[model samples]
Target chain A: MKPILRIGSGAGFSGDRLEPAVALAEHGALDYLVLECLAERTIALAQLRRVADPAAGFDPLLVRRLRPLLPFIKARGLRLVTNMGAANPLAAARRVVELARELGTPVRVAAVTGDEVLELLDPAQPTLETGQPLAHYPQLVSANAYLGVEALLPALASDAQVIISGRVADPSLFLAPVVHHFGWSLDDHERLGQGTVMGHLLECAGQLTGGYYADPGVKDVPGLAWLGFPWADVDAEGGMELGKIPASGGIISLATVKEQLLYEVTDPAAYVTPDVVADFCGVRLRATGPDRVRVEGGRGSPRSSTLKVSVGYRAGFVGEGEMSYGGHNCVARGRLAGEIVRERLAGEFAQLQVDLLGVSSLHGEERGAQSRPYEVRLRVAGRAEDAARAARVGEEVEALYTNGPAGGGGARKSVVEQVGIVSCLLPRDRVRTGVEMFGP
Target chain B: MKHKLFHLAHSRAGDKGDTSILSLIAYRPEDYPRLCAQVSAQAVKALLAGLVQGEVRRFELPDLEALLFVCEHALATGVTTSLRLDAHGKSLSSALLEMEIEMDRDIDTRIPTHAHAHTPTQGS
Candidate 1:
């Protein structure tokens, strides 16, 4: 058995920096590079794009991201895995093949599909968020099950150099290669759980390497401008050490690791992904050296019988308008502009939110005893059923310049069709997964 | 002595549906108990009364000297549906750090005096 397997995270999210990933591929000496690009609402929005154009559902940055790394994977024989195939994996796979051919680098690509289960969804099935039936949402756009390591293992087993998927669990993207390389059984929940700990730690790429951390005077992280992505050296037993390229910038201390360990995690004892119920409660981290931390003591139990499905539906439009007021009683002027908009559009929309950006936008309306600010931005936003109704909200806010509040400059307005996402649990057997191969 | 939670701890916020998950870790392990005592679920809910409309649950990880808070109905109504400018509630962590806590005593002498000094490398 291999003493240690090296896996590097390329991109944490859809819009993460491309250079860090290229740096990993060129310098990290990694056996596998996993780019976890899909967010909870990404696939639903991708589904909307697919409706507009059949071949446009994949991540927009897929080709731009792959263009730089194709040479390293082709030369070093390194494998690549990603959920960049947000709504369509086959098309993404085809695009990769075309890019490889253009670069004169021959490679095999695999597309993992069957996450989409819109047809199988029953209107009567209750959702997890509101406990309301699926029928309650008439404009349902998409339903996708979160696939696990099992879905990607077949592609890994194949000769495919690149594996593209849609809506796979984020951590599962890293865990699949570990399972395949070690020939670990899917039923081995303990090792799967330990492997999951490594996956969770590395999935956010730069986050593990101190990108999101750094509070100048408080928790200081140096060289963030050129922050390096992270990689894990995993052993057969699933113990690992997380580190970054030595020449790269960033810190890998207990603070960064501990903060990321519980990120988005509601329960450390039970972090449920598709493969296993990973127990991070007892996990330990030790700073072995500069830019390196050893992680161990993670355990797991049997996998859950149900898989989480993200349901996306059309939730109407959000109309927003912003205008600035400055110099002398700006707070009062901003509030007056907000009140005028609220009174003009009162009872017209389902919900209207007005706030003075400099003072009361983020926390809430209750501002207790604060000094007057020289400038404040008046922002008015409302949710409406149609685009025209939403546009009216911006029009009223813009009218504040001449009609109501003085010095209402730099006015900006936008109308966006919102896609709302909710979750539901479906039996694992209900969702079928498959893989397709493409080559130049 | 009065101290802002920001001086004692640092936090990061994340979102799932309409729920916001914030992890608060003490800068020093010795301060963990103080956070456990003062940063109760009730205290957190009351502090974030404007954003959080549901129950607040806190989970402790004594080993890491950290506290994880799960606030339901906190993201307005999830990221995509929420009309707030900060739909993901990413700034809520800073908001939570604004809480005031009455310290049991003055600063300890053992604490590093060069806390703000940015060393080039933490280790060789």
Candidate 2:
């Protein structure tokens, strides 16, 4: 891996641009291709999908596209690693296997689990803050721990071409391939730190590139469409080179890289993870080139005693409804309707307990006060039944189209009633993360 | 509220080493004078470079912004640093928040050792 071949991960696309990601994989001849699509709301969407169809798993967009690319990856013999298996890796594996067989590619597939800790949850257990066990909240829905990539090592070690995991920490998805291939030990703090950093940058894909950064210069790079995915050629020792595929859209400029660097950091000295406490204080970022940003100089120390667990429990119910109003009084009238809806709900179903997420409201703007052209969205959350009732609230506003202020036609659809689950993270010591891996 | 915290409690837990992605956001750049009176990047860098006893060898972040920094670490220190409002004084608190705080880790550093070559290579 001399001169270390590497590329930026997907440039902020949610694996939907599989064509470009695969193209990048082929062109870059990458040793590893990591696809990350999980986020906070993503978990909720996954749960909803599971509810719709237990066998259905992941977003299915990657596997669907990968079917065509499997031949290329198989011919090039590149490894694929991703956390696309939202809640069920095994099921996702089955889907991948089916897709591969259909494509007539004998690709080895592996699934990693153990992140879901819902089965270990006891209703009688109290909240870490409140002594009362979680049983009090009957709304407890989904609970999962942030599974590290330690378990995926064996699968990758087996030389599996495709490794699918459930709820893997986004950064770990990228780090696992490097660790497994390089055979890095469990305690190499510096190397793991490097892997983790790489994963973080790759996890967001293009966001670290020019997608989020508002660069003044360098326009007409190409279609933002068909963006390239990121890859890394990591050696055992922990040094890395940051690069991306050729002809990829967007520039990895200094401003772009800097914007991503400031994505989610609290302090420079105590940057912590389940694996290590990285010191960001001594780090440096310089634009190596158009799509290349160089990173060097970082410090690390031992981790704390336990890994913090991210557990999701059923919080309450929420319903979101939207209506589009065209014309001059759009923003103002929309807000007025929102206030009316809330007042009506409070007056009628105060006990129903609905919280209105003033749709697109600003930091301190008074409701219905802003005068701007806008679409209005109203969100209400409470008990399950309350959320259902809130969905009906949209109808009342629809009825107002004929009699209400600014009597003009408006359209409302996709009245959604959903429950919110809150993950009260516990220490890893308190949760279980054990899963059995089956192989040939 | 609905976030997955990659809590790097400890950095030296494996042979693979540790890393992180950090982001920094600066609330105000004009407060540099007051902020310099309070905290310095050099001080933070020194703290990171300090010879801490642990398995984590080094850490880094690739990019940084005005008041924000995103980074990955080799080892994680669970403890958090608190800037007491009273310690900085109320007059400085506003400026402190407005001050562009540097965050984000994206580099890999090695602990100084007597046996290594110019730059550490693959094998131990």
Candidate 3:
């Protein structure tokens, strides 16, 4: 087993910043960098784009996120991993090849695929929570089974400078390198679980570092504007010390670690991923130093018989509009403005949400003991089956400028068709995952 | 005197579908016992009375001095479809801070910090 594996988090989501990732590559002296960019809805949106243009559907910002860091990647041999392939892995892998050639950077790249189980998805499959069949949905847009590290190992084995994948489990992107380098048994539940927990912690990118940890005076984060991404110094035993780059501007305290450890975890005892069932309840953590935490003791059991799949279907459209009102008793005017729009769209939409932004959106029904605000924004949003019908809500809200509220300003509106989702379990035996390599 | 969870703990919220999950971590290791006693699933359910349409399930992580509260059907719909302003129910973590938990009888301050001194939590 290798002594230590240093992995840097490049980007957390599809739209995460590249600067912190570049900083990590240049100065952090990282062995591997994992950028988890895919989300549940992201794949569905990408699938829609792929339908429109066969050449598109991959992350549009993939090149921009990668081009600047090619030098660090080439010179330092920094093996980078990201699921920025979105819905199109091959195309995305090719983009990296084209970009590398353009910049005279020689790096082996690979894309892991077979996540798209759209064709195999049967409407007869029962949903996990609701138990209803997929037939209940009107339109089925895209379906992908969340893959694990088994697909990523081959690509890592190829000694690639960068690895791109579509729809692999977020944690698996980071876990693949550890498994590849250490030659750890995939069946070793405890160690896999240990590494998986680290993946989950770093998967949110800047979240562990401090981007989302801030709450102003209550939970203040300094240098937040220049927030750095988190990286880990992991051992072959799967234990690691989590820290951020110098001047990364985030606390890696017991609280921050604990918060991230439990984030999105419904059950502390059974945090399920494709590779292992991690039991985070027994996990231990302590403040190792400034911007660092020594995290260990993550336990695990055998993998689940079935994998969770995110099935996206074409849900209708959302119509939204917002207008601000200023100067004296603005709440009344904002309320009136929303009421006017509500009356116009009555019975035409499924539901209309009218919010006096400063009052309802932030304060809820309770204003506490605070005095009334000088300004409020009238916001109305609703859903419909078609674009024209959905567009009516926003159009009516805009119409209220001349038709109702006297001093309404900054009126904005939008209509968007949505990709909705249903969750189902797929049998483990059904999926076949593999990696394809490209570039010099 | 009664103390809210915020006085002894800090929380972060995340969402999947209609459910909103908040992880509440005690500021000090000594405060874990208080959290175990006071932050019951029933109490969280009651605190989110009208806001949460479904039940609240609490999962313990004593190793981390944390409790994960999963509030089901908390969002009107999922984030993608929900017309709610916050979309992901990001504000609900602060909303949970308002919940009144039983304070120790010896404690005098209205918003008492935990027994442990503050570790430098600020990042710069």
| Each prediction's RMSD to truth | 2.6, 11.7, 2.9
Candidate 2 ranges beyond 4 A from true positions: A1-8, A11-16, A44-54, A122-133, A215-222, A232-236, A315-317, A321-336, A349-360, A366-387, A424-440, B1-65, B69-124
lDDT ranking from best candidate downward: 1, 3, 2
Which numbered prediction scores highest in TM-score against the true structure? 1
Give the Cα error of residue B73 in candidate 3, in Å: 0.5
How many Å off is the CA of A86 in candidate 1? 1.0
Candidate 2: tens digits of C-alpha lDDT, residues A1-440: 33453533642434455566667666877767777766544555566678788987576575665676677667776777777777767787777777888877767778877777776776776654234566765654456666666667777777568877777667677777776656667577677776676776677776654454321231223446655555544555656556667677665544444445444444556656665676655556554445655565555676555544444444334333444555565556665665665666675454322221233322123322343434444333222345555455556556556644463354353333443333345566664444333332
User: Docking category for candidate 2?
Assistant: incorrect
lDDT for each residue of candidate 3 in B12-87, tens digit (9 for 90 to 100): 9898888899988776667788889988999988887766789899988777777889999888777777888888
- Residue-level lDDT of model 3, residues A26-96, one tens digit each, is 98989998888998899999989999998788998899999988788867868989898989999999899
lDDT of 3 at A168: 88
TM-score of 1: 0.96
By TM-score, the candidates rank as 1, 3, 2
Q: Assess the local accuracy of residue A30 in candidate 2 as a C-alpha lDDT between 0 and 100.
A: 71
Please name the candidate that would achieve the greatest lDDT relative to the true structure.
1
TM-score of each: 0.96, 0.71, 0.95
Residues A76-114 of candidate 1 have per-residue lDDT tens digits of 769999999999999999999999999999789999999
